[model samples]
Target chain A: MKQFFIFVKKEFFHIWRDRRTLLILFGMPIMQVMIFGFALTNEVKNSKIGILDLSKDEATAKLSERISASQYFDLVENLKSSSDIDASFRKGDTKMVIIFPEHFRESLLHSNSVQVQLIADASDPNTATTLINYASAIINDYQDELMGETKLPYTITTQTRMLYNPQQKGAYNFVPGVMAMILMLVCTMMTSIAIVKEKETGTMEVLLVSPLKPIMVILAKAVPYLLLSIVNIISILLLSVYVLDVPIAGSLALLMFTSILFIITSLSLGLLISSFTASQQTAMLISLMGLFMPTLLFSGFMFPIENMPIPMQVISNLVPAKWYYYIVKSVMIKGLGIEAIWREVLILTGMTVFLLTVSIKKYNVRLA
Target chain B: MTDEKVITAKALTKKFADFIAVNAISFEVSKGEIFGFLGANGAGKTTAMRMLCGLSLPTSGEATVAGFDVYKESEKIKKNIGYMSQKFSLYEDLTVKENMRFYGGIYGLTEKRIKEKSQQVLADLHMEAEQNKLVKSLPLGWKQKLAFSVAIFHEPAIVFLDEPTGGVDPVTRREFWEMIYQAAQNGTTVFVTTHYMDEAEYCNRVSIMVDGRIEALDTPTNLKKQFNTASMDEVFLQLARKAVRQAD
Candidate 1:
């Protein structure tokens, strides 16, 4: 126990001595969280749209007023002619344009049908889809109110209800994903780089030659990162809950335990990388290119695995972060227990064991 | 007195696939002696030292360090030995006193013992005033000396130094030898490896390795007389040339 404390103290000294590394470790996570939370949002609001209302009638005027009043469209301009639509969109001021035909009110009143065109810029597919859906919903609601008195046969009304994330706040999804990502980055990548740094600096030889066993040295190096990862997990959870209003609906203790398990798995993977690479730079590149990208892209963090291409969907199963993300989402969002996420938990456990075994084997072989 | 051999190796060999780093060789060093393992770069000096320190395993040999079997009792051997590398293995960010305390602590020394020994070690090196300063702030010579002192702080049975004085001034190297002599006087065996032929003269006895084999094993004076050379460097050159001729 005394030896362990001494080792942990040495690890803390290494961290405290490197001020720049400490800053990058703590600051990057919060910065990424705030940036992803606020800057990149899925909810469409105040989207600028141009209206070309050719019909000088009460119906067209009312429809224009409704479009302008809705929060989704800002009604940036009212163009005079169809040629003006091209110029306005070219300026990039409007994301979409609504065109009303000349006999729109007459056609609607006499024949109960009118043609209106909604043109959306498809450069950003997600934003374009959101704007079109918002506009369509407002128009549909208006038509339903207008024809309230007329009873029609085979009338169908659709009520959409979102489960778990009712508000569809991006923070709800990102807070959990960011927590997993940051933990993996700090615990796994940093630990691997630290070990490789020792190798590069030749300090690893000194430690190995000392009276300390190789396994004990590795354990000592990992203990501080494990503790720091736990602390980061708590900080992220607190920030998400208090600052962003993202709740942990399940038991906090269970979430903490599972997060620790994932952090250990990440650290084990880092050790494996360190064992393979002789230089810190190589270890860092491997961790980032080989681990970080896959964790971010295929771990169900940004893109849903179910919606991915078949090969990519298959690759997602190989990333440990995918299992961790599933566990966190299940516990935090769905309020589920170990019984619900036991499969993911078991997979993570198995990966941790496999990585740790391989690293130990490699380390022994190198020593021999 | 027959049991005074601190290290014993018989037909010790280490090979990495087809490359024989340290071929089958045997040697022994008595307790309280400064034994120098001399060689050029890639001459298997480091490979042999690593095996003796229990950091690496011998391929096919029987070796014991400080009365512990190298194969089955490496951990016991480690606990009885101290190691200082050519890299000057001390934490640069830590203070002199902190480095000593840390190593002592890791070796399972009590806090009181660490404090007492750290003070004594610092005082012995005339570095009492510099204890609070970070190691990185010190001169290279002082760091090397401090690293050597810290490695043997626990007064282990044997301290293995893999070229402990690689890039230091001659004056500091001389002072470092004095410390090694003091440790030897205190009944601690010193097993050191070095490329500097002059530094090998400071050892009680030295072994010259060429082409992964020990070409000469004797005192510096005896080696010079045996090879009919003026200095250890000329003796080493002659042996290396002879080995090359044999290989051709």
Candidate 2:
């Protein structure tokens, strides 16, 4: 045990002396969390909109005022003629144009409806689609206010309540996803590169011939990374709570335990890669392509797993990050306990054990 | 030491899938003797050395290092032997004293012992002033010497050196040999492999490996006399000329 501490200390010295590695280990998590928290978001806000109110009536003016009052749209301009819509879009001043036809209130009062044409720039289809929804929602609210006590014959009014995130903040979704990603990157990628580096430098042979057990050598390599991964988890969690205001609804201890399990899973994966790779470059390539790419695309971080193809959904089950992301969301956002996340915890534990067993077997076979 | 054998092997071999890296070859090294394992670049000297050091396993044969079985008691063998790989294996980012402490700690040396041993090692190399410098800042010869010193820091029964003086100048090579002789004189058996034929003459006994087998195992003078050559270099060329395996 004392010798193991010595080995871990040596490993830390390797990390400490290399300024670039230190930067990557500490700086990458903060940068990734900030990027996912602030930049890469699905929520639509402050969309620039143009209103062409040809009706010039009380009801149309009230609708325009309600849309502008909502946080979703900035209400960039009010155009006189319909021809001005093209210029607004061309100047990038408005993302959506709302045209209210003349006699809008008279038509709604007598017949029951009026034509409110919503034209949106489809150049960025996602933002355009979201903006159109926001505009329609604002107009619907305005109509509801206009219909004070008069109930429609058969109006299917739908009320949506964002369950976990009340305000529909993007940080709630990203905090967990970023945690999964940063843990995978720091533990799996960095550990594999460190082991392969020792092999490339011929130091692995010396370690192999030492009194230390092969298993202990592997543990010694992992211990420093494990500590660093914990530090990273803490940094990201602190950033999420303090900077991004993403809450941890479950027990913080349970969240940390799950993070530790995921980190070990990643470290075992790295050891497996290091067992087969002869150089640091090969280790890095395999970790990035085999681990990071799948974690990014298939882990349900940026995309929904259920929406994927059947084959992709099946493949996603094998990605540890996918399970970890779900677990993080359940614990931190959904406020679920161990009962809700036990299956994912088991799967991650199974992966860690499987990778560890396979890598140790590979190491032994190679040594023989 | 009364002809005590530190290493004993019979028909040791290593095969990589379809390829036989080390053919069944046998040799023995007495205590405190400088046993030279001379071969061309890919003559399987390293493969054979790795097996003896417990870093590799023999496919089919019986071998013992420091009186431990190569197959089952490899852990015991590991504790009793020191190895210096072909590439000087020291952490470039770590200072000389730090590398010493790391190696010593891994080999189960006590903290006080590591400190004393490190000071002694630095003093012997006349590097006491530079003990805090990173290994990358040192010259190649100095790094090589430091690597050798660290390899034997645990004072193991057998010290294995694989191409220890490959790229150093002649003077440095001679000085490195003097260190080897000093170690051998202190009753530490030195098992070394090298491509330098000139180093073969300094060994108490030299084994010339061709392809994957040791073609000749004798003193340098005897080898030259038997091959009817004036130097060990010509003797090696004559033997390597009839080799079948290409240098891998």
Candidate 3:
């Protein structure tokens, strides 16, 4: 235990003395969270639309007014003819073109029917789909207001409360995910590469031949990273709450407990990688390719796991980060406790144990 | 003095898959003696040293280091031994004092002992003026000397130097040998491996390894007389040629 503390002190000196590593450990998460929060948003607002008002009637004018008033669409261009529709889309200014057929109001009133053409730019499929849905919903609402007495046969209403984030703030989701990813990256990859660096510099042999126990040496290396990762978690939480206005719906203590658990899982994975690789470059490549990519890609940080293929979903179940991501989202966004996310917590704990056991076993085998 | 050898090995072998890196080699080194392990590149000197240092497992033979069985009490033996590799293994980013403190600390030295020993080691090496500088900024000779000092900073029973003076100038190497002599005088057994045949002359007893086995083990005078050569270098060259000829 005394040797372990001394080794931990050395590890802390290494971390505190390296400026560049310090930056990557703390600065990266804040930068990533702020960038992903403010710059990249899914909410579609002020989308430009080209209008071809062939009817030039009161009803058509009322519909256009409603579409412009609804914050989703902006009237950017008045196309003189149908031929201009394709040109407007190609120029990229107009995301959609609304065409009103000739005698549209007359047909709707006298024949109880009218046809309107809604052309959308499908270059970006997600934005296009959102735009179409917004336009459709607004038009349907206007139709309901016009025909107040007509009762629809079937209707479904979705009241999306978005509990913790009432406005569906992107930061509330991204802050937690970024925190998970950055913590994993810093703790696991940095620790693994640092160990491999000792090998590269030939310091590992010196340490092994010393009075220090191998297990104590590994713990010494991991403790500083574990502490730093906790600091990173706190910074991210503070940034999310204060700057991003993303509340911590669950207990702070629980969130911290889960974060520490995940940090251990990540650190153990790093140690496992370091045990297999001889060089810092190899350790880094393996950590990034094997751990970071899977953590970021399959852990539901950028993409929803439910939308992934079946095989990928099965593979994601093996990634410790996946469970941790779920745990963070549950505790932070859903305000769920251990009872609500016990399975995810259990998976993370199991992964931590399995990885740490494997790494320790491998280290012993190498020593032998 | 204790009537027990500090190091003893019988047919100690290390094999990697099909290749026998250290093949059935045997030797012994008494306590408080500067024992030199000599071989050319890939002659299995390092492999044997690693086994003695408890860093590698011997495949098919028995060995003991610091009176502890190599296989069973490897960790205990490690605690009793210190090692300095060919590479200057000190953390270059740390100051000289910091490096000493770190190595001493991890070896379970108390804070007071670390401070006192570091001061003594630095003063002994005449490096007290540069203790605050990062090790990377130190001269190669100084760094090598400091590495040696740090390896034995915990005052282990044995210190293993794997080519401790590999790249230093002859003058510095002599001065470094003085430090090793000092360590031996203080009753620390020195087990060193070197390619420089001239260095083998400085050992109390030297062993020549050729192709994973010790070909000759004796005092420098005995080896010279046995090989009918004027110096240890000539003895090594003749033995190396004879080994190559036999292989051919």
Candidate 4:
């Protein structure tokens, strides 16, 4: 244990002394996080929606069918009570909610007046805004049909309300996306370079021949990167909340827990890359070309995964960053708890475990 | 120097698939002896050194370092031996003192010991004024000498050098041998592999490997008499002519 600390300290010194590595380790994450959070735009399709129909009338059913039949919306669930609106949003079961009055058909016949409400979780303002527009258009089409013969016009006033994000800030959607991309890029590229630097300079052979345990050597090498990645996470989160003005609506502790898990997954991927690469350049190249593109493309950060081809959609499931992006978005934007993001958390954990197993198997701790 | 053996091997072998890299080679090194391992490129000198250093597993036969079996007690063997390679060793980005303290610390030395030993190492090299400089800023000769000094800093029972002085001035190489002689006199067994025949003349006993086997091993004078040559170079050439493995 004493030796392990000493080794970790040495590893830290290596990181501190090299200017280029120091820049990539600390500078790149902060720059990318800020750049991406403020400037990136988001677009999404196939957003799931829920319907709360107190009347259960033919008119309510027909509107729900019209919304679901469109390519932009997927009617996923029926909310049994008004209370279920918050629960459905928190569980990520729906992106938007449509509520009908108790006697929609009766009220229209008696007074030629009724009301309909569309509530959206505006943490993702683009998707929320688009869904509201689509649903309002459908309700207006229904209202136009009823106005064909009546002089009163039987008005259906559509009201749209945003939950969680009242101001509909743009940071809500892409902050989590930026966090996933930065973590994946910085953690992976830094660690693989650190490990491969030893191999390139021949320090690894010296370390391997020492009395220190090979496992200890590997752990010592990874510990510094892990801690630095945590620091990056804290910086990104602070910037999002303070500078970008996006609040953490879920449990802060759970948010950190999931971020650390994702960091470990990226570090293990770095280790696997180091095992196959003999030079620091190769490690850095693989980290960039292999990890960065997939993360940006498949994590739904830069491109909407839903709008992709079927083969791409299937392939996106294998990207670890995709799940991490989902977890962060659910926790930070939708204000969801572990009950909603637990499956994503589990998937990240499983990827970390598998990556660690394969990397340890491939990593040559000896000179052979 | 006592005659107690610090390393023993009995037909230790290593095979890479169909190729036999080290085939049933056996040797022993007594304490305080400067044993030179001489070979042409691809002659399996490094493969044998790796097995003895507890870095590679032998396919057959047996070996021991510092009274511990190479197979079952490699960790212990590593604790008892120091290794240096010609390709590279110390962290170039770290200061000379930092590199010393780092290696010393990982060897389980205390803070005070690391400080004191680092000071002593710097003073011995007449480099006390340059201790704070990064190793990359130093010249190649000084770096090699510092690497050799740091490798044996833990006072391990045996120090293994895989061509420690590959490219350097002849004067610096001579100075490097003086350091090895001083260490051997202080009761540390030195096991070195080298391409320089003159360096082999300085070893107390030299082993010539050709094609995965030790073709000849004896005192320099004895080897000269056995090979019927005037110097170690002709002795190497006469034996190396038998090698069939192509050098990379």
lDDT of 2 by residue, B1-248 (tens): 33999999899999989988899999999999999998877889888988898878899999999898999999899888999998779999999999999999988899999999998999999999999999999999999999999999999999999888978999989999999999999899999988888898899999988888989999888998999999999998999998888887
Q: Model 3 over residues A67-120: C-alpha lDDT tens digits?
A: 888777889898989889878887877877878788877776666556667777
Question: By how many angstroms RMSD does model 2 differ from the true structure?
Answer: 5.2
Please give, for residues A219-293, the per-residue lDDT of candidate 4 as tens digits: 898899889888988988888788866799998899999999999999899888988899988998899888889
Q: Please report how far candidate 4 places residue B121 from its true position, in Å.
A: 1.0
Query: Could you tell me the lDDT of residue B3 within candidate 2?
Result: 94
lDDT (10s digit) by residue, model 1, range A1-368 = 77878988988999988999899888877787777655434245788998888987897788789989988789889899999987887887687888778877677666666666777665554466567667767777766766775642212122322222233322226777898789889988899988888888778887887767788889889998998887788777877777666689888888988898899999999999999899988998998999899988988777667667899988899899999998999999779998999999999999999999999999998887
* Cα-based lDDT for every prediction: 0.83, 0.87, 0.83, 0.87
Which is superior by DockQ, 1 or 2?
Answer: 2
**Candidate 1 Cα deviation (angstroms), residue A281:** 1.4
The CAPRI-style docking tier of model 1 reads medium
Interface RMSD of 3: 1.2
DockQ, all candidates in order: 0.68, 0.72, 0.65, 0.61
Please list all clashing residue pairs in model 3, or write none if there are none: none
Please tell me which predicted candidate would have the highest TM-score against the true structure.
2
**Chain A structural similarity (TM-score) per candidate?**
0.71, 0.74, 0.71, 0.67
- Off-target runs (Cα >4 Å) in candidate 4 are A40-172, A364-368
| Stronger candidate by DockQ (2 vs 3) | 2
